[model samples]
Target: MHMISALLFGAPDAHGSRRRADLVQDLLWAHSDPEDAVQHIRVRPHPVGLEAVLLLGGRADGAATAVVALLGRSAAPLSRQGYTALPPGAPVQPPVPSGPGD
Candidate 1:
């Protein structure tokens, strides 16, 4: 079970992003392999639209295909602009530096 990551763009707003995430999860649950896809998801604000990070369970190509198909049928304004297979334990995002005041 390899780990795959993807970024989905084009969400109207924060609320819309949340809705999109929920819809994605539901769709994946219904459409994808029961135990080999869509492990986790996170949403963040972006200039064009909200960006979502999807952690999937499979090879890069397979994961991308599943996500693309799911997004195509989702009916939400979301598109997978980028995705990659991650090495085990690789950090999805860079670590944030703490301020001195903290």
Candidate 2:
């Protein structure tokens, strides 16, 4: 099994963050595969709004796909209610060495 993490922002307050976290948990429970794909979930306050993390169990790609779908499905309504998702940063690549052969 693999683990995937998601972060959500823009909750008005701690209560709002907790509520949104609960909604996310419910959605995952109802929609994810095996009915237990969500292994763990958490929410904490952030300066901009709130932060949430979800640990999912499954193949990495599949888990990512599920999260994408879940976010897509919730984005509109959530945005209308003032919640936003924190986009992930691009993966860093190692620098390649270029030198004359000895």
Candidate 3:
């Protein structure tokens, strides 16, 4: 029997780096990628919701792959050709206006 550590989970930093990292968790709480070395990380808001896209480099010099979070705590790996770098959704639509007259 295997038990996953709870400390490994969290609201990941949508914008951060984990270069040559030993531990990289996908948006989906799937298996922890302790084998591969994480080269890059990109988090963007999609139509479904916000997610993290992990760019991984193989440990023993394998080809790179893009990993995304699915429905739950699980990850789906994709090829570079299949992955799309969509523009991040805007956080705020219209900025609140403040006048000199308090």
The candidate maximizing TM-score is 2
Kindly give the number of clashing pairs for every candidate. Answer: 0, 0, 5
For candidate 1, give the lDDT of residue 68. 60
Shift of residue 34 alpha carbon in model 1, Å: 2.6
lDDT of 2 by residue, 25-77 (tens): 56545544544466765555556554556677867666666666666666765
TM-score of each: 0.45, 0.56, 0.27
Ranking 2 against 3 by TM-score, winner: 2
Off by over 4 Å in 1: 1-36, 76-102
The candidates, ranked best first by TM-score, are: 2, 1, 3
* Model 2 misplaced stretches (Cα beyond 4 Å): 11-36, 88-102
Model 3 clashing residue pairs (backbone):
28-73, 28-74, 29-73, 29-74, 30-73
- Which residue pairs overlap in candidate 1's backbone? none
- lDDT for each residue of candidate 3 in 1-102, tens digit (9 for 90 to 100): 111111122223344334201223343224335443445444444333233555455542332222212211132231111222222232423223458995
